[model samples]
Target: MNFAKPLPNYLVKRYHGWKATTYSENQVWYRRLATEGQRPRAMVISCCDSRVHVTSIFGADQGEFFIHRNIANLVPPYAPDGDHHGTSAAIEYAVTALKVAHLIVLGHSQCGGVQGCIDMCKGQAPQLEAKESFVGRWMDILKPKFDLVADVEDSTDQARQLERQAVVASLENLMTFPFVSSAVEAGSLSLHGLWTDIGEGGLQCYDPKEGKFSEV
Candidate 1:
C-alpha cells in the first residue's frame, strides 16, 4: 500500500537524538527490557493531550508504567456488551495480565475533552452532541460531572472541578469491572485518582474521605 505521508522531520530528528543519548546510555537496560517482558507495577490512565507528561511527572523509566492515553483520560462504565472498548480492554489487561498493584486515573487542568463535555452539555458544542462523534460519546462519561460543579460561576473553575470529577468518575467506573473489584476486595489491587495543574505544575491527589483534591 502506498503511504499517505512521510514521518515528520522534527520527530525523525527527535528519534535520532533518543538513539544517541538515552538509548546509548541505557543500551543494556533497553536490551534487557526488550528480551524480558515488561512487569510494570502501576498502570497510568491519562489524557491524550500532549502537555500531560505522565513519564516526566513520575520520572519513570521505560518499563516502569503501563500507560494508556485517551481523550480526557476517561474510563466509561463497564458494560461488557462485547463491543470495542479500548479503555476497558486496557484495564482488563493491566489488572488481569500485568497484575499491576495500582491503577491511577490521572486528569489534568484545561482538558479540551472536559471542556467539550461542559460545552456539549450546555448546548455550546453541537458537533459533540452528535451521535457519530467519537469524542462526544467518549466525553459522555464525564458529562454527568458538569452537574456536580454547576454552581461554580467561573468557567475555568468549572472546568477544573469537572477535571477532578472525571478522575473520580473513572475510579468508580474501574470498580464496576468484576476482575478489578475482586482484586481490590482481595487486597491485590488499589485504585487512585490524581489531577494535575498543567500551568502551575502542581499535583493534587483525591481524598475520598474529604471528597476533595489536595495538593501533593
Candidate 2:
C-alpha cells in the first residue's frame, strides 16, 4: 500500500501553512519558549487516545505541560530493568529534572486500553504478538483490578471502575519511584486522579469521602 498517496493532500498542505503562520504571528511567544527552557508547573499522565488531549483540555499553550501519554496512561512500579521504560523515564524527568509540583493521572471514560483489561479478565483476551508490545504488557499491570471488577453489575460501571482503579494504581506506582517518593515526602510533589467524561463534558475528581468518582 502506498501510504503517502492515501493522505488527503489538503490536510498535508495545511501543516506547512500553519508552520509559516505560527512563525510569523506567534514569533515572540515562540522565541520565549525556545529561549526559556520548559518549566511546566504540572505534569499529566494521560492516554494516547486522540479524544483525550491534555493541552487542549487544560487550555494550555506551548511549554505549559510536561505530558507523558501511553495506552491507558499507565505508570508501572519502579524497577531497574535493563529495558526501555518510556513511562518511567518520563516520570523521572518530570519529578527529578523538571521538578513539577503537581502530577495528575488523567483517566477518561470508555477507555479502550482499560477495556482490554476487562476482556482479558473475562477470558476473551486479545491475541498476543510474538514480541512483547508496550500496551499489551502494561495492561497486565491492571490485571488484578480487572479481575476484581469483572463481575460488577453493569458493563459500563465495570469499565468505569477499571478506569478509576488504573488511575489510582498508577499514582501508587508513581510513589514507587525513589525520586518521586522523596519529593512527595518533602511536600514538593503532589498527586491527583481525575476522570473526564467526554460525552457529558463533565470533570470528576476521585473523592476519598465517597471512595469513588464524583463530579468536580
Candidate 2 displacement at residue 1 in angstroms: 17
lDDT of 1: 0.94
Cα RMSDs, all models: 1.0, 2.7
- Provide the lDDT at 31 for model 2: 90
- C-alpha TM-scores of all predictions: 0.97, 0.90
Number of the top-ranking candidate, with lDDT as the measure: 1
- Local distance difference test, each candidate: 0.94, 0.86
In model 2, what lDDT does residue 172 have? 82
Clashing pairs in 1: none
Per-residue CA lDDT of model 1 for 112-188, tens digit only, reads 99999999988999998889999998898887778889889999888889999999999999999999999999999
TM-score for predicted model 1 compared with the true structure: 0.97
